[model samples]
Target: MNAVSTTSAERVRADLVRARSARSARESLIKGLLFLAALLSVATTTAIVVTLLQQTISFFGEVSPLAYFAGTKWTPLLSGDQQSFGVLPLLWGTFYLTGIGLLVAVPCGLLAAIYLAEFAKPKVRKTVKPILELLAGMPTIIFGYFALTFVTPVILRDVFGIPVSEFNGLAAGLVLGLLVTPTIASVAEDAMRSVPQSLREGAYGLGAGRLQVALRVVFPAALSGIVAALILGASRAIGETVIILIAGGQSPSMSLNPTGSFQSMASFIAATARGDIPQGTLKYETIFVVGFTLFCVTLLLNAVSTRVVSRYRQVYE
Candidate 1:
């Protein structure tokens, strides 16, 4: 009987050890998979950067850096007419569109986030959030069409009584802004929700009014997150292609007017690539150079956002 009892105890111990070993193995597998995924993402980004740099260097070899930077004209097809590929116009157009888009997105998105997070009932929020998310998921080309066919012509002709141009940066930027608002709202709302309940309670304990607590305590605490969200939205606006391609004119004008037609870097690339430019041609390589510029701009924005978020991060007990 003693031997049988000892045997049963040993079996139970063995089973427990085996179960722990299996769990550890599963955890290790999951961690390894995640690590590999992260590594792959980094590798892909690095490859893209390297490829763009290589192509850009080749393009600069054919076209002088001075001409690319200083000259105003951008006639890649005409070699004898003193063609200039000054990137400033394209860069300015990008910023102009991005600024306009952000101007529209930030206020609307932040307000929506405030309502959803602080004011809305659960049922209302549940319905609204999904609908907003659906808007985000809609294809950019669809938004481009909406901007071109519906918004621009209607508003410009009907409201302003002006002949609407086929391409308008303001319309594109506005549509892009609408598209990005949901993303900002979702991020900002999550950030706001992450505020500690203790902070709110403390404000209440001090006899603070609801608006005072929200403005003074909550908003300040969440400012870092809100800034990060805005930065991300800006990044999206900068990288947007389809809406700009359809609504923003192909002309890389240096105009800052919201109503004027302009081309973003992404839109320019899309337009250029659509032409039958031979592979290994100057124009072909220029696309890579533009892409490289776009990538660097977005990277810088992300880095700034990261620094700002870190600097202003709030600590709570």
Candidate 2:
């Protein structure tokens, strides 16, 4: 009986060892798969950067950097004496639209976030927050149409009596602001909500009013996150292609007039997507230069965000 019991105990031990080994192997396989998935994202980004840089270099060979950067014109396809490719017009147009978009988004979004975070009852929050966020998921093209058909004519024309073209930067920027508002509101609300409740309570204990506690205590604690949210909103506005494309209209000009039709970097890329010139020609290569410029701007924004977060990140107890 003793020998039989020993043999059964050894068999059970062997089965347990095998089970552990199988589990370890499964985990190892999953880790390997996850690493490859991350690597794929890195590889794709590297490929794009390499492709754009190579073409941009080739473009510089055809068109001098001085002419591309300093000149005010952007008519790369213009015949004979009219050809130019200055980048300022595109850059300024992009900035003008993005600036106007931020104006519309930032205050409204921050105010909404403040209400949801500090003031709203759970029932009201539950009802309103999701609907606000739903705006982010709505297709941008729809917003573009709304900008052109309704915004330009009805709001700008009828209410303000402002002169607005069929497709103007002001209309596009306002609509883009509405499109970007959800992103800012969602991120900023999360930031504000993450503030430690103890801080709020302490402020209250010190005889602070609700407004004072919320503004002075909670808002300061969440400043870094709020800044990050604003950065994200700015990036979204800068990269937006479809809304600007449909509503802002593609006529590259160095004008700051909000009511005037202007072309954004995104719209420029979209306008030239058809590769109107033969491959390897100077006209064809202009797209790559523009693309590279956009990429650089995005990279700069991300770098600034990283620096801002690191410099101001709170060390909480």
lDDT of each: 0.87, 0.89
Ten contiguous residues with the weakest lDDT in model 1: 73-82
- Write down the lDDT that model 1 would get: 0.87
lDDT of 2 by residue, 17-119 (tens): 9999999999999999999999999999999999899999999987899998898998887888888889998998888998999999999999899999999
Report backbone clashes per prediction. 0, 0
**What is candidate 1's lDDT per residue for 118-182, written digit by digit as tens?**
77899999999888888878899998999899879897768877665778788988888988999
Clashing pairs in 1: none
- Models 1 onward score TM values of 0.86, 0.90
Cα displacement (Å) at residue 112, model 1: 1.1
Model 2 TM-score relative to the real fold: 0.90
Highest-TM-score candidate: 2
Q: Output the TM-score of candidate 1.
A: 0.86
